[model samples]
Target: MGKLKSYQKQFQTLLDKGIDNAEIRHKRMVTRPFDFAEKLEKEAKSYSFKSVRQAHNQYAKSLYSSLRTLNERANGYAADLIARIDKEAAAAGAKSGNSKQPAKKTSTRRSTTAKKTASSQSSRGTASTSTASA
Candidate 1:
């Protein structure tokens, strides 16, 4: 269980780092180039590219950031679920261990006494019924 927790933490950390790296790469490779191109187009007074690349880049970055946050939240949820499962498994294991002992057998003498008592009670009931009928 401890190992599982450790692994979950490590995996979450890795995912966080991966998300950060991806954001950095996206800023460097996509947003920065689009910004530069938008500037160049504005300076050159070229209306040929009417695609609104800068606005698209901005929207894309906003969406990407949201996705990154959502991914991190998902990782957190997964970690919580793993922890919960581990706790339940440990509890079940403990219950099973305690219950795994062999059940105690009833003493033969006690069983014999119980049988005798039952027979006597039945005989008395029959005798009472006979007396009532009489």
Candidate 2:
């Protein structure tokens, strides 16, 4: 009801017009949860024999439960969601776009190991070539 201070005039106008569009419906939908939350907070401060944090936590839990009853919870959202999924899939060794994801200043030790492995392979190849010719 505290949050409703802004909308008292608007609600009155709607009552007079008798039109219920998404805007009016949406306002009611949003305000209802807030009103429920405020009531819960007041009850926590008044009736409960508990610590402030404990009462506050209970209030939050109740508020979330009320909100869940109000709205449709869903799986995913927009283009950013798709892009994030693609990044995670690529990280799990699935192929993604060629555009590189910048990694931080990596371990030089790994690069050194890679260089050593390449040099060892080249030396082995050279030895094999000479042995074959001989």
Candidate 3:
């Protein structure tokens, strides 16, 4: 139990940190190109046409590189989070003596069938009572 709690705390911390880092990275990834574009637009009048085109091309390449980097980092973060969750879940299951195999899932179809039968029986009873009164 204590070990489970420790894992839980560690998972939470990692999740929080991951979220913060992702948010920061996402903001930079989203905003940097726009900021650069704005700067380019501002400086466009001072530079010749060729230089402006070159700058735009460079910006596009950098933006693509950054996007790729961000994607890789996000994937890494997701993998880390999944690993932490699996570790925590395994610890919890072990503590509960369920680590040997997955738990059996109860069938919802049985419950739905039972409910339909119950509703049909109740409706029949009501109909019979109404006929008797009539």
Question: Which one is best on lDDT?
Answer: 3
Q: Which ten residues in a row have the lowest lDDT in candidate 1?
A: 125-134
| Per-residue C-alpha lDDT of model 3 across residues 54-95, encoded as one tens digit per residue | 989999999999999999999999999999999999999989
- List the candidate 3 regions with Cα displacement exceeding 4 Å: 1-48, 99-134
Residue clash pairs of candidate 2: none
**Candidate 1: clashing residue pairs, number:** 0
Candidate 2 Cα misplacement greater than 4 A, ranges: 1-20, 47-134
- Best TM-score goes to which candidate? 3
Model 2 scores a TM of 0.22
Write down the lDDT of every candidate, Cα atoms only: 0.81, 0.71, 0.84
Estimate the TM-score of every prediction.
Answer: 0.36, 0.22, 0.39
Sort by lDDT, best first: what order? 3, 1, 2
Better of 2 and 3 by TM-score: 3
Q: Which residue pairs show collisions in model 3? A: none
lDDT of 1 by residue, 12-100 (tens): 99999999999998888998789989898787675434556776788999999999999999999999999999999889989888545
Model 2 worst lDDT window (10 residues): 70-79
